[model samples]
Target: MSLRMATDADVPAIAALMRASVRAIFPRFYDAEQTAGAEIHIAHLDRAMVDDGTYYVHEDGGEVVACGGWSRRARLYTGSGDRDDDARLLDPATEPARVRAMFVRGDHTRRGLGRAILEASERAAGAEGFTRLVLMATLPGVPLYTAFGFAEVRRVDVTLPDGIVLAGVEMERPVTAGRTRCPPGRP
Candidate 1:
Protein backbone atom coordinates (compact mmCIF):
# COMPACT_ATOMS: atom_id res chain seq x y z
CA MET A 1 0.00 0.00 0.00
CA SER A 2 1.12 3.52 -0.80
CA LEU A 3 -0.11 6.77 0.78
CA ARG A 4 0.38 9.93 -1.20
CA MET A 5 -0.94 13.45 -1.57
CA ALA A 6 -4.09 13.66 -3.63
CA THR A 7 -4.33 15.73 -6.81
CA ASP A 8 -7.20 17.20 -8.79
CA ALA A 9 -7.12 14.26 -11.17
CA ASP A 10 -8.00 11.92 -8.33
CA VAL A 11 -11.29 13.67 -7.44
CA PRO A 12 -13.57 11.45 -9.53
CA ALA A 13 -12.20 8.22 -8.13
CA ILE A 14 -12.16 9.63 -4.62
CA ALA A 15 -15.78 10.73 -4.86
CA ALA A 16 -16.77 7.28 -6.07
CA LEU A 17 -14.89 5.66 -3.23
CA MET A 18 -16.59 7.98 -0.73
CA ARG A 19 -20.05 7.08 -2.05
CA ALA A 20 -19.31 3.38 -2.09
CA SER A 21 -17.99 3.49 1.44
CA VAL A 22 -21.04 5.32 2.72
CA ARG A 23 -23.43 2.96 0.98
CA ALA A 24 -21.69 -0.09 2.34
CA ILE A 25 -21.07 1.04 5.90
CA PHE A 26 -23.82 3.50 6.80
CA PRO A 27 -26.67 0.98 6.86
CA ARG A 28 -25.39 -0.41 10.15
CA PHE A 29 -25.83 2.93 11.90
CA TYR A 30 -28.44 4.81 9.89
CA ASP A 31 -31.84 4.28 8.28
CA ALA A 32 -32.38 4.19 4.54
CA GLU A 33 -33.32 7.87 4.28
CA GLN A 34 -30.42 8.98 6.44
CA THR A 35 -28.06 6.82 4.43
CA ALA A 36 -29.28 8.30 1.20
CA GLY A 37 -28.91 11.81 2.55
CA ALA A 38 -25.38 11.05 3.67
CA GLU A 39 -24.54 9.60 0.28
CA ILE A 40 -25.66 12.82 -1.36
CA HIS A 41 -24.31 15.39 1.07
CA ILE A 42 -21.46 13.74 2.94
CA ALA A 43 -19.91 11.74 0.13
CA HIS A 44 -18.46 14.64 -1.78
CA LEU A 45 -15.14 15.97 -2.92
CA ASP A 46 -13.73 19.10 -1.32
CA ARG A 47 -11.49 20.38 -4.03
CA ALA A 48 -9.99 23.02 -1.77
CA MET A 49 -8.24 20.42 0.31
CA VAL A 50 -6.53 19.12 -2.79
CA ASP A 51 -5.55 22.61 -3.88
CA ASP A 52 -4.22 23.37 -0.40
CA GLY A 53 -2.10 20.20 -0.46
CA THR A 54 -3.77 18.74 2.60
CA TYR A 55 -5.59 15.75 1.12
CA TYR A 56 -4.23 12.24 0.68
CA VAL A 57 -5.09 9.06 -1.21
CA HIS A 58 -3.98 5.56 -0.39
CA GLU A 59 -3.53 2.98 -3.09
CA ASP A 60 -3.29 -0.78 -2.88
CA GLY A 61 -2.15 -2.59 -5.99
CA GLY A 62 -2.53 0.60 -7.99
CA GLU A 63 -6.14 1.22 -6.98
CA VAL A 64 -7.26 3.96 -4.63
CA VAL A 65 -8.48 2.34 -1.46
CA ALA A 66 -8.78 5.27 0.97
CA CYS A 67 -8.69 9.06 1.02
CA GLY A 68 -8.66 11.74 3.76
CA GLY A 69 -7.12 15.05 4.71
CA TRP A 70 -6.58 17.91 7.16
CA SER A 71 -7.26 21.56 6.50
CA ARG A 72 -6.18 24.84 8.05
CA ARG A 73 -9.18 26.61 6.63
CA ALA A 74 -12.27 27.61 8.54
CA ARG A 75 -14.59 24.95 7.16
CA LEU A 76 -15.21 22.26 9.73
CA TYR A 77 -16.77 19.71 7.39
CA THR A 78 -18.33 19.40 3.99
CA GLY A 79 -22.00 19.16 2.93
CA SER A 80 -22.92 21.54 5.74
CA GLY A 81 -24.12 24.88 4.49
CA ASP A 82 -21.19 27.22 4.10
CA ARG A 83 -20.64 30.01 6.56
CA ASP A 84 -19.42 33.51 5.75
CA ASP A 85 -15.93 32.68 6.97
CA ASP A 86 -15.74 29.19 5.51
CA ALA A 87 -12.94 30.11 3.17
CA ARG A 88 -10.91 32.06 5.69
CA LEU A 89 -7.60 30.70 6.93
CA LEU A 90 -7.38 29.54 10.50
CA ASP A 91 -4.71 30.31 13.03
CA PRO A 92 -2.95 27.09 13.90
CA ALA A 93 -2.10 28.40 17.35
CA THR A 94 -5.68 29.04 18.36
CA GLU A 95 -7.77 26.82 16.10
CA PRO A 96 -7.40 23.12 15.66
CA ALA A 97 -6.81 21.93 12.15
CA ARG A 98 -9.89 20.40 10.63
CA VAL A 99 -9.59 16.74 9.78
CA ARG A 100 -11.72 16.75 6.69
CA ALA A 101 -13.24 14.07 4.48
CA MET A 102 -12.12 10.52 5.18
CA PHE A 103 -13.36 7.51 3.24
CA VAL A 104 -12.09 3.98 2.87
CA ARG A 105 -13.27 1.57 0.23
CA GLY A 106 -16.04 -0.75 1.41
CA ASP A 107 -13.82 -3.75 0.86
CA HIS A 108 -10.78 -2.25 2.53
CA THR A 109 -11.59 -1.92 6.21
CA ARG A 110 -9.53 -3.42 9.08
CA ARG A 111 -6.36 -2.98 7.05
CA GLY A 112 -4.90 0.06 8.86
CA LEU A 113 -5.58 2.44 5.98
CA GLY A 114 -7.53 4.84 8.15
CA ARG A 115 -4.87 4.80 10.83
CA ALA A 116 -2.15 5.46 8.31
CA ILE A 117 -4.00 8.42 6.86
CA LEU A 118 -4.56 9.89 10.31
CA GLU A 119 -0.91 9.48 11.13
CA ALA A 120 0.10 11.42 8.05
CA SER A 121 -2.47 14.08 8.77
CA GLU A 122 -1.33 14.56 12.34
CA ARG A 123 2.27 14.81 11.40
CA ALA A 124 1.59 17.30 8.63
CA ALA A 125 -0.65 19.43 10.77
CA GLY A 126 1.76 19.32 13.66
CA ALA A 127 4.58 20.40 11.41
CA GLU A 128 2.49 23.36 10.40
CA GLY A 129 2.20 24.39 14.10
CA PHE A 130 -1.27 23.09 14.74
CA THR A 131 -1.73 21.88 18.28
CA ARG A 132 -4.93 19.92 17.80
CA LEU A 133 -7.14 18.24 15.23
CA VAL A 134 -10.89 18.22 15.06
CA LEU A 135 -13.49 16.44 12.97
CA MET A 136 -17.22 15.98 12.64
CA ALA A 137 -17.41 12.24 12.22
CA THR A 138 -20.29 10.18 10.95
CA LEU A 139 -21.44 7.38 13.22
CA PRO A 140 -19.61 4.78 11.17
CA GLY A 141 -16.41 6.77 11.54
CA VAL A 142 -16.61 7.56 15.26
CA PRO A 143 -15.05 4.29 16.37
CA LEU A 144 -12.08 4.78 14.14
CA TYR A 145 -11.62 8.37 15.28
CA THR A 146 -11.90 7.33 18.89
CA ALA A 147 -9.33 4.60 18.44
CA PHE A 148 -7.02 7.19 16.95
CA GLY A 149 -7.22 9.29 20.15
CA PHE A 150 -10.08 11.59 19.31
CA ALA A 151 -12.57 12.27 22.08
CA GLU A 152 -16.18 13.19 21.56
CA VAL A 153 -17.04 16.78 22.28
CA ARG A 154 -20.70 16.52 21.41
CA ARG A 155 -23.25 14.76 19.27
CA VAL A 156 -24.56 16.65 16.26
CA ASP A 157 -27.52 16.19 13.96
CA VAL A 158 -26.91 17.64 10.56
CA THR A 159 -29.97 18.39 8.46
CA LEU A 160 -29.25 17.69 4.86
CA PRO A 161 -30.77 19.62 1.99
CA ASP A 162 -33.52 17.03 1.73
CA GLY A 163 -34.47 17.58 5.40
CA ILE A 164 -33.05 14.29 6.63
CA VAL A 165 -31.16 14.42 9.87
CA LEU A 166 -27.84 12.59 9.96
CA ALA A 167 -26.31 12.07 13.36
CA GLY A 168 -22.62 12.72 13.86
CA VAL A 169 -20.04 13.23 16.58
CA GLU A 170 -17.78 16.16 16.99
CA MET A 171 -14.39 14.87 18.00
CA GLU A 172 -11.04 16.36 18.83
CA ARG A 173 -7.49 15.22 19.56
CA PRO A 174 -4.14 16.82 20.19
CA VAL A 175 -1.63 16.75 17.37
CA THR A 176 1.18 14.73 18.82
CA ALA A 177 4.06 13.99 16.53
CA GLY A 178 4.74 10.28 16.07
CA ARG A 179 1.71 9.39 18.20
CA THR A 180 0.04 7.07 15.73
CA ARG A 181 2.02 4.01 16.78
CA CYS A 182 -0.08 0.92 17.39
CA PRO A 183 0.09 -1.16 20.51
CA PRO A 184 1.87 -4.49 20.50
CA GLY A 185 0.21 -7.13 18.29
CA ARG A 186 -2.28 -4.59 16.96
CA PRO A 187 -2.58 -3.68 13.29
Candidate 2:
Protein backbone atom coordinates (compact mmCIF):
# COMPACT_ATOMS: atom_id res chain seq x y z
CA MET A 1 0.00 0.00 0.00
CA SER A 2 1.02 3.57 -0.64
CA LEU A 3 -0.23 6.90 0.64
CA ARG A 4 -0.60 9.95 -1.55
CA MET A 5 -2.31 13.32 -1.70
CA ALA A 6 -5.81 13.34 -3.12
CA THR A 7 -6.85 14.99 -6.38
CA ASP A 8 -10.08 15.85 -8.19
CA ALA A 9 -9.62 12.73 -10.28
CA ASP A 10 -9.84 10.64 -7.12
CA VAL A 11 -13.25 11.96 -5.99
CA PRO A 12 -15.41 9.23 -7.49
CA ALA A 13 -13.45 6.39 -5.92
CA ILE A 14 -13.20 8.33 -2.70
CA ALA A 15 -16.96 8.77 -2.53
CA ALA A 16 -17.56 5.09 -3.08
CA LEU A 17 -15.04 4.19 -0.41
CA MET A 18 -16.67 6.61 2.00
CA ARG A 19 -20.11 5.12 1.44
CA ALA A 20 -18.90 1.56 1.82
CA SER A 21 -16.90 2.30 4.94
CA VAL A 22 -19.74 4.18 6.60
CA ARG A 23 -22.35 1.58 5.81
CA ALA A 24 -20.27 -1.31 7.10
CA ILE A 25 -18.93 0.34 10.24
CA PHE A 26 -21.56 2.79 11.43
CA PRO A 27 -24.17 0.15 12.08
CA ARG A 28 -22.00 -1.10 14.92
CA PHE A 29 -22.44 2.18 16.79
CA TYR A 30 -25.66 3.64 15.41
CA ASP A 31 -29.24 2.44 15.30
CA ALA A 32 -30.99 1.73 12.00
CA GLU A 33 -32.61 5.17 11.82
CA GLN A 34 -29.39 6.92 12.75
CA THR A 35 -27.39 4.85 10.29
CA ALA A 36 -29.80 5.66 7.44
CA GLY A 37 -29.61 9.35 8.27
CA ALA A 38 -25.85 9.27 8.62
CA GLU A 39 -25.51 7.43 5.32
CA ILE A 40 -27.03 10.47 3.65
CA HIS A 41 -25.29 13.02 5.82
CA ILE A 42 -21.73 11.72 6.14
CA ALA A 43 -20.83 9.83 3.00
CA HIS A 44 -19.32 12.54 0.82
CA LEU A 45 -15.91 13.48 -0.51
CA ASP A 46 -15.24 17.19 -0.11
CA ARG A 47 -13.28 18.44 -3.08
CA ALA A 48 -12.01 21.36 -1.04
CA MET A 49 -9.88 19.04 1.03
CA VAL A 50 -8.10 17.96 -2.12
CA ASP A 51 -7.85 21.56 -3.30
CA ASP A 52 -6.29 22.51 0.01
CA GLY A 53 -3.82 19.68 -0.51
CA THR A 54 -4.56 18.27 2.89
CA TYR A 55 -6.49 15.19 1.90
CA TYR A 56 -4.86 11.79 1.35
CA VAL A 57 -5.71 8.37 0.01
CA HIS A 58 -4.14 5.01 0.71
CA GLU A 59 -4.17 2.87 -2.36
CA ASP A 60 -3.45 -0.79 -2.94
CA GLY A 61 -3.16 -2.24 -6.43
CA GLY A 62 -4.51 1.01 -7.86
CA GLU A 63 -7.59 0.98 -5.64
CA VAL A 64 -8.28 3.46 -2.86
CA VAL A 65 -8.82 1.65 0.43
CA ALA A 66 -8.79 4.57 2.84
CA CYS A 67 -8.98 8.37 2.63
CA GLY A 68 -8.92 11.32 5.02
CA GLY A 69 -7.52 14.81 5.52
CA TRP A 70 -7.18 17.97 7.59
CA SER A 71 -8.33 21.46 6.69
CA ARG A 72 -7.56 25.07 7.43
CA ARG A 73 -11.19 25.95 6.80
CA ALA A 74 -14.15 27.17 8.85
CA ARG A 75 -16.49 24.22 8.55
CA LEU A 76 -16.25 21.49 11.15
CA TYR A 77 -17.95 19.10 8.74
CA THR A 78 -19.95 19.26 5.55
CA GLY A 79 -23.71 19.65 5.53
CA SER A 80 -25.76 16.83 3.98
CA GLY A 81 -25.68 16.39 0.15
CA ASP A 82 -25.11 19.98 -0.91
CA ARG A 83 -21.63 21.51 -0.74
CA ASP A 84 -21.85 25.01 0.71
CA ASP A 85 -19.53 27.98 1.11
CA ASP A 86 -17.76 26.57 4.13
CA ALA A 87 -14.28 26.94 2.82
CA ARG A 88 -13.54 30.23 4.59
CA LEU A 89 -9.88 30.34 5.50
CA LEU A 90 -9.03 29.79 9.12
CA ASP A 91 -6.72 31.79 11.36
CA PRO A 92 -4.26 29.20 12.56
CA ALA A 93 -3.21 31.66 15.21
CA THR A 94 -6.56 31.54 16.93
CA GLU A 95 -8.35 28.44 15.64
CA PRO A 96 -7.59 24.77 15.75
CA ALA A 97 -7.13 23.26 12.33
CA ARG A 98 -10.03 21.04 11.35
CA VAL A 99 -9.38 17.31 10.92
CA ARG A 100 -12.12 16.73 8.44
CA ALA A 101 -13.44 13.69 6.56
CA MET A 102 -11.83 10.37 7.63
CA PHE A 103 -12.95 7.00 6.35
CA VAL A 104 -11.40 3.58 5.69
CA ARG A 105 -12.69 0.61 3.75
CA GLY A 106 -14.26 -1.94 6.10
CA ASP A 107 -11.74 -4.61 5.18
CA HIS A 108 -8.91 -2.21 5.88
CA THR A 109 -9.81 -1.43 9.47
CA ARG A 110 -7.32 -2.14 12.33
CA ARG A 111 -4.44 -2.04 9.90
CA GLY A 112 -3.16 1.40 10.99
CA LEU A 113 -4.42 3.38 7.96
CA GLY A 114 -6.47 5.70 10.14
CA ARG A 115 -3.52 6.33 12.39
CA ALA A 116 -1.33 7.09 9.42
CA ILE A 117 -3.81 9.65 8.06
CA LEU A 118 -4.28 11.24 11.49
CA GLU A 119 -0.54 11.57 11.91
CA ALA A 120 -0.14 13.06 8.45
CA SER A 121 -2.90 15.56 9.22
CA GLU A 122 -1.35 16.60 12.53
CA ARG A 123 2.02 17.07 10.92
CA ALA A 124 0.59 19.11 8.06
CA ALA A 125 -1.48 21.24 10.39
CA GLY A 126 1.48 21.79 12.68
CA ALA A 127 3.65 22.76 9.74
CA GLU A 128 1.07 25.50 9.11
CA GLY A 129 1.79 26.82 12.64
CA PHE A 130 -1.33 25.33 14.13
CA THR A 131 -0.83 24.18 17.70
CA ARG A 132 -4.18 22.48 18.03
CA LEU A 133 -6.53 20.18 16.11
CA VAL A 134 -10.23 19.51 16.38
CA LEU A 135 -12.77 17.23 14.72
CA MET A 136 -16.39 16.19 14.92
CA ALA A 137 -15.87 12.44 15.21
CA THR A 138 -18.55 9.90 14.46
CA LEU A 139 -19.35 7.52 17.31
CA PRO A 140 -17.50 4.67 15.60
CA GLY A 141 -14.47 6.91 15.25
CA VAL A 142 -14.27 7.97 18.88
CA PRO A 143 -12.08 5.14 20.06
CA LEU A 144 -9.49 5.82 17.43
CA TYR A 145 -9.44 9.56 18.10
CA THR A 146 -9.31 9.05 21.83
CA ALA A 147 -6.43 6.64 21.50
CA PHE A 148 -4.63 9.20 19.39
CA GLY A 149 -4.62 11.69 22.29
CA PHE A 150 -7.75 13.65 21.45
CA ALA A 151 -9.96 14.62 24.36
CA GLU A 152 -13.69 14.73 24.15
CA VAL A 153 -14.94 18.28 24.55
CA ARG A 154 -18.65 17.69 24.21
CA ARG A 155 -21.38 15.59 22.70
CA VAL A 156 -22.89 16.87 19.48
CA ASP A 157 -26.26 16.05 18.02
CA VAL A 158 -26.20 16.46 14.27
CA THR A 159 -29.69 17.08 12.96
CA LEU A 160 -30.13 15.32 9.64
CA PRO A 161 -32.36 16.47 6.81
CA ASP A 162 -35.03 13.94 7.68
CA GLY A 163 -35.22 15.20 11.27
CA ILE A 164 -33.17 12.35 12.67
CA VAL A 165 -30.32 13.39 14.94
CA LEU A 166 -26.97 11.63 14.71
CA ALA A 167 -24.61 11.64 17.64
CA GLY A 168 -21.04 12.82 17.35
CA VAL A 169 -18.23 13.90 19.61
CA GLU A 170 -16.31 17.13 19.52
CA MET A 171 -12.69 16.26 20.16
CA GLU A 172 -9.56 18.35 20.44
CA ARG A 173 -5.87 17.78 20.98
CA PRO A 174 -2.81 19.99 21.29
CA VAL A 175 -0.25 19.24 18.62
CA THR A 176 3.18 20.75 18.50
CA ALA A 177 5.55 20.53 15.56
CA GLY A 178 7.21 17.34 16.82
CA ARG A 179 5.19 16.29 19.82
CA THR A 180 2.15 14.59 18.34
CA ARG A 181 2.47 10.81 18.51
CA CYS A 182 0.46 7.70 19.32
CA PRO A 183 1.45 4.14 20.22
CA PRO A 184 0.11 1.45 17.92
CA GLY A 185 -2.75 -1.01 18.53
CA ARG A 186 -6.26 -0.42 19.95
CA PRO A 187 -5.27 1.18 23.22
Candidate 3:
Protein backbone atom coordinates (compact mmCIF):
# COMPACT_ATOMS: atom_id res chain seq x y z
CA MET A 1 0.00 0.00 0.00
CA SER A 2 1.10 3.55 -0.67
CA LEU A 3 0.53 6.26 1.90
CA ARG A 4 0.26 9.87 0.84
CA MET A 5 -1.35 13.21 1.56
CA ALA A 6 -4.94 13.49 0.41
CA THR A 7 -5.92 15.91 -2.31
CA ASP A 8 -9.28 17.50 -3.01
CA ALA A 9 -9.99 14.96 -5.71
CA ASP A 10 -9.85 12.15 -3.15
CA VAL A 11 -12.57 13.59 -0.90
CA PRO A 12 -15.52 11.78 -2.41
CA ALA A 13 -13.87 8.38 -2.39
CA ILE A 14 -12.56 8.86 1.13
CA ALA A 15 -16.03 9.76 2.32
CA ALA A 16 -17.51 6.65 0.75
CA LEU A 17 -14.87 4.49 2.35
CA MET A 18 -15.61 6.06 5.74
CA ARG A 19 -19.33 5.38 5.50
CA ALA A 20 -18.73 1.83 4.37
CA SER A 21 -16.30 1.20 7.19
CA VAL A 22 -18.81 2.49 9.73
CA ARG A 23 -21.65 0.37 8.35
CA ALA A 24 -19.53 -2.76 8.42
CA ILE A 25 -17.90 -2.27 11.80
CA PHE A 26 -20.28 -0.25 13.98
CA PRO A 27 -23.03 -2.86 14.24
CA ARG A 28 -20.91 -4.98 16.54
CA PHE A 29 -20.76 -2.15 19.09
CA TYR A 30 -23.77 0.05 18.41
CA ASP A 31 -27.48 -0.44 17.89
CA ALA A 32 -29.06 -0.01 14.48
CA GLU A 33 -30.14 3.58 15.12
CA GLN A 34 -26.76 4.52 16.51
CA THR A 35 -25.03 2.93 13.58
CA ALA A 36 -27.13 4.93 11.16
CA GLY A 37 -26.46 8.09 13.11
CA ALA A 38 -22.74 7.42 13.05
CA GLU A 39 -22.83 6.77 9.34
CA ILE A 40 -24.35 10.21 8.86
CA HIS A 41 -22.57 12.23 11.48
CA ILE A 42 -19.24 10.52 12.09
CA ALA A 43 -18.45 9.23 8.64
CA HIS A 44 -17.66 12.54 6.98
CA LEU A 45 -14.74 14.35 5.48
CA ASP A 46 -13.48 17.49 7.14
CA ARG A 47 -12.59 19.85 4.36
CA ALA A 48 -10.55 21.95 6.73
CA MET A 49 -8.24 19.02 7.36
CA VAL A 50 -7.85 18.63 3.65
CA ASP A 51 -7.25 22.33 3.10
CA ASP A 52 -4.69 22.37 5.87
CA GLY A 53 -2.91 19.43 4.28
CA THR A 54 -3.25 17.28 7.39
CA TYR A 55 -5.35 14.43 6.01
CA TYR A 56 -3.94 11.31 4.36
CA VAL A 57 -5.06 8.32 2.36
CA HIS A 58 -3.55 4.85 2.07
CA GLU A 59 -4.02 3.24 -1.29
CA ASP A 60 -3.48 -0.31 -2.51
CA GLY A 61 -3.50 -1.06 -6.22
CA GLY A 62 -4.39 2.61 -6.67
CA GLU A 63 -7.54 2.31 -4.55
CA VAL A 64 -7.98 4.03 -1.26
CA VAL A 65 -8.06 1.35 1.44
CA ALA A 66 -7.61 3.51 4.53
CA CYS A 67 -7.81 7.21 5.44
CA GLY A 68 -7.11 9.42 8.46
CA GLY A 69 -5.20 12.44 9.70
CA TRP A 70 -4.33 14.88 12.50
CA SER A 71 -5.24 18.54 12.91
CA ARG A 72 -3.52 21.54 14.46
CA ARG A 73 -6.71 23.56 14.46
CA ALA A 74 -8.95 24.06 17.46
CA ARG A 75 -11.77 21.95 16.13
CA LEU A 76 -11.66 18.60 17.89
CA TYR A 77 -13.82 16.56 15.54
CA THR A 78 -16.49 16.79 12.93
CA GLY A 79 -20.26 16.86 13.77
CA SER A 80 -19.38 18.62 16.99
CA GLY A 81 -21.16 21.77 15.84
CA ASP A 82 -19.37 24.79 14.52
CA ARG A 83 -17.59 27.09 16.90
CA ASP A 84 -16.35 30.65 16.47
CA ASP A 85 -12.82 29.48 17.12
CA ASP A 86 -12.88 26.24 15.14
CA ALA A 87 -10.30 27.55 12.73
CA ARG A 88 -8.04 28.96 15.39
CA LEU A 89 -4.51 27.63 15.46
CA LEU A 90 -3.57 25.44 18.41
CA ASP A 91 -0.64 26.13 20.65
CA PRO A 92 1.36 22.96 20.21
CA ALA A 93 3.04 23.32 23.56
CA THR A 94 -0.22 23.65 25.47
CA GLU A 95 -2.79 22.01 23.26
CA PRO A 96 -2.69 18.54 21.89
CA ALA A 97 -3.00 18.06 18.16
CA ARG A 98 -6.29 16.51 17.18
CA VAL A 99 -6.28 13.03 15.69
CA ARG A 100 -9.31 13.43 13.46
CA ALA A 101 -11.30 11.10 11.21
CA MET A 102 -9.84 7.60 10.86
CA PHE A 103 -11.35 4.76 8.89
CA VAL A 104 -10.37 1.56 7.07
CA ARG A 105 -12.16 -0.51 4.46
CA GLY A 106 -13.83 -3.55 6.05
CA ASP A 107 -12.08 -6.00 3.74
CA HIS A 108 -8.71 -4.36 4.36
CA THR A 109 -8.70 -4.14 8.15
CA ARG A 110 -6.30 -5.71 10.68
CA ARG A 111 -3.46 -5.44 8.21
CA GLY A 112 -2.02 -2.55 10.23
CA LEU A 113 -3.57 0.19 8.09
CA GLY A 114 -5.06 2.02 11.07
CA ARG A 115 -1.80 1.76 12.96
CA ALA A 116 0.07 3.05 9.96
CA ILE A 117 -2.14 6.13 9.81
CA LEU A 118 -1.74 6.75 13.51
CA GLU A 119 2.01 6.42 13.24
CA ALA A 120 2.07 8.89 10.39
CA SER A 121 -0.13 11.29 12.33
CA GLU A 122 1.96 10.97 15.47
CA ARG A 123 5.15 11.61 13.58
CA ALA A 124 3.74 14.65 11.84
CA ALA A 125 2.30 16.11 15.02
CA GLY A 126 5.48 15.43 16.95
CA ALA A 127 7.50 17.15 14.28
CA GLU A 128 5.25 20.16 14.72
CA GLY A 129 6.12 20.19 18.44
CA PHE A 130 2.81 18.90 19.66
CA THR A 131 3.31 17.23 23.00
CA ARG A 132 0.19 15.07 22.79
CA LEU A 133 -2.58 13.86 20.55
CA VAL A 134 -6.32 13.57 21.22
CA LEU A 135 -9.35 12.16 19.45
CA MET A 136 -13.02 11.43 19.86
CA ALA A 137 -13.31 7.85 18.70
CA THR A 138 -16.41 6.03 17.53
CA LEU A 139 -17.09 2.82 19.46
CA PRO A 140 -15.77 0.76 16.56
CA GLY A 141 -12.46 2.62 16.66
CA VAL A 142 -11.76 2.46 20.40
CA PRO A 143 -9.81 -0.75 20.33
CA LEU A 144 -7.53 0.43 17.58
CA TYR A 145 -6.85 3.73 19.34
CA THR A 146 -6.30 1.96 22.66
CA ALA A 147 -3.83 -0.43 21.11
CA PHE A 148 -2.01 2.57 19.69
CA GLY A 149 -1.26 3.87 23.21
CA PHE A 150 -4.28 6.17 23.60
CA ALA A 151 -5.93 6.29 27.01
CA GLU A 152 -9.61 6.98 27.38
CA VAL A 153 -10.43 10.22 29.15
CA ARG A 154 -14.20 9.70 29.23
CA ARG A 155 -17.22 8.43 27.38
CA VAL A 156 -19.22 10.97 25.41
CA ASP A 157 -22.46 11.06 23.49
CA VAL A 158 -22.63 13.32 20.46
CA THR A 159 -26.12 14.16 19.32
CA LEU A 160 -26.54 14.15 15.59
CA PRO A 161 -28.57 16.69 13.62
CA ASP A 162 -31.62 14.44 13.87
CA GLY A 163 -31.16 14.19 17.64
CA ILE A 164 -29.75 10.69 17.60
CA VAL A 165 -27.06 10.35 20.21
CA LEU A 166 -23.92 8.55 19.10
CA ALA A 167 -21.67 7.30 21.85
CA GLY A 168 -17.92 7.75 21.61
CA VAL A 169 -14.76 7.76 23.67
CA GLU A 170 -12.43 10.70 24.25
CA MET A 171 -8.87 9.44 24.11
CA GLU A 172 -5.41 10.93 24.35
CA ARG A 173 -1.79 9.90 24.16
CA PRO A 174 1.49 11.65 24.75
CA VAL A 175 3.62 12.24 21.67
CA THR A 176 6.65 10.29 22.75
CA ALA A 177 9.59 11.02 20.48
CA GLY A 178 10.38 8.21 18.05
CA ARG A 179 7.75 5.91 19.60
CA THR A 180 6.46 3.71 16.82
CA ARG A 181 4.80 0.80 18.63
CA CYS A 182 3.19 0.44 22.00
CA PRO A 183 5.42 -1.07 24.65
CA PRO A 184 4.53 -4.64 25.68
CA GLY A 185 1.75 -4.80 28.31
CA ARG A 186 1.06 -1.07 28.08
CA PRO A 187 -2.44 0.17 27.47
Of candidate 2, the 10-residue stretch with the lowest lDDT total is 78-87
* Candidate 3 lDDT tens digits, 1-187: 9999999999989999999998998899889998888888889898999999899999999899899999999989887577899899999989999999999999998999889889989999999999999999988888899889899999998888778888889999999897765857865
Residue-level lDDT of model 2, residues 74-102, one tens digit each, is 88886443445477888988999999889
lDDT for residue 72 in candidate 1, whole number 0-100: 91
Off by over 4 Å in 3: 181-187
lDDT of 1 by residue, 52-149 (tens): 99999999898889999999999999877768998899999899999999999989998989988899999999999999999999998998998888
Q: Would you estimate the TM-scores of all the predictions? A: 0.95, 0.92, 0.95
Q: On a 0 to 100 scale, what is the lDDT of residue 99 in model 1? A: 96
Q: CA shift at 20, candidate 2, in angstroms?
A: 0.3
Error of 2 at 112 (Å): 0.6
Candidate 1: minimum summed lDDT over ten consecutive residues — where? 177-186
